[model samples]
Target: MPVRRDRLRRAGESAFGALLLTRMILMTLLALLMVTGGAWSSWDTARDALRPPQGAAGPLTLAACDRERCTGTFGPSGETVALYQRIGREPGETLEVALRPGTAEVVRTGAPGVLYACLPLAGSLLLAGIVIGGGLRMYRTAWATAGAGIALLATAFALW
Candidate 1:
């Protein structure tokens, strides 16, 4: 009976070790993917903000204005579009916005555009931090990553 109990304990330990190794590998791969994706998205967004496509540039008639989002209509064709920007504009006003490439969404140019462009990078870091802290148990690194994200967001908000 004692021999059987010892064998069971050894099996459980081996299983736990394998599980931990698999989790570490998965966490590393996920972290790498997140960093790569975040960088790509950040670059794309920033480039678009800096130099928006001329074909998509136009004036929009804003119908509603809130803190985070604005609803508006665009074109002589009256195409409905949602502008996800934190621009300081009032409803019943016409604002010039450029469509994000390949999408109906618009981002304000200049400072607002740049600020909004940073959001995806911040989000990615935040998500990666959560995963690393919870899944990989790297508490300090996770906190640092989260702190960086917060700083990035704060800077964007201040500049916006």
Candidate 2:
């Protein structure tokens, strides 16, 4: 009877260990997914905003804004266009912009543009940190991850 009871106790402990390992794996996968998804989604816009001006280069004259979108005119051509990202600029404000091919929108080519485009990646880092810390019990790594996100956010806001 004692032997049987001992065997049951060992089995329960092993099962608990297995469950814990499975939980850790799931959490890690979730964290990876969040980070990768954010990067994938933001890549094109962020790259366009961060790189040197290409294609059409001009001063965009903001014509009007409704809620999150602003319509403007691009360059000497006076082509009606839109700001690639939502901004707080009012009508008549002019900004240097680069026109994206196949789109009626232009991306701002400076720090402000880069920051705006990277906002999602920063958010993902923060969320990933929470999962790594609380779910995987990697406190130090989590703190580092979250710190990176905070840094990015701060830099973006400060320069914007």
Model 1: lowest-lDDT 10 consecutive positions:
1-10
Q: Which one is best on lDDT?
A: 2
Task: Estimate, for each residue in 1-160, the C-alpha lDDT of model 2 and write its tens digit.
Answer: 3545588898999999999999999999999999998788777787777673455777898899877778888886689998845446789988877777788878776877787778899999999999999999999999999999999989987765
Q: Rate residue 94 of model 2 by lDDT.
A: 89
- Cα lDDT, model 2, residue 73: 84
Residues 73-149 of candidate 1: C-alpha lDDT, one tens digit per residue: 98643777778765566888886667776677876667756767878888888888998898899999999998988
Per-prediction TM-score, please? Answer: 0.61, 0.86
The whole-model lDDT of each prediction reads: 0.80, 0.83
Clashing pairs in 2: none
| Candidate 2 worst ten-residue window by lDDT | 48-57
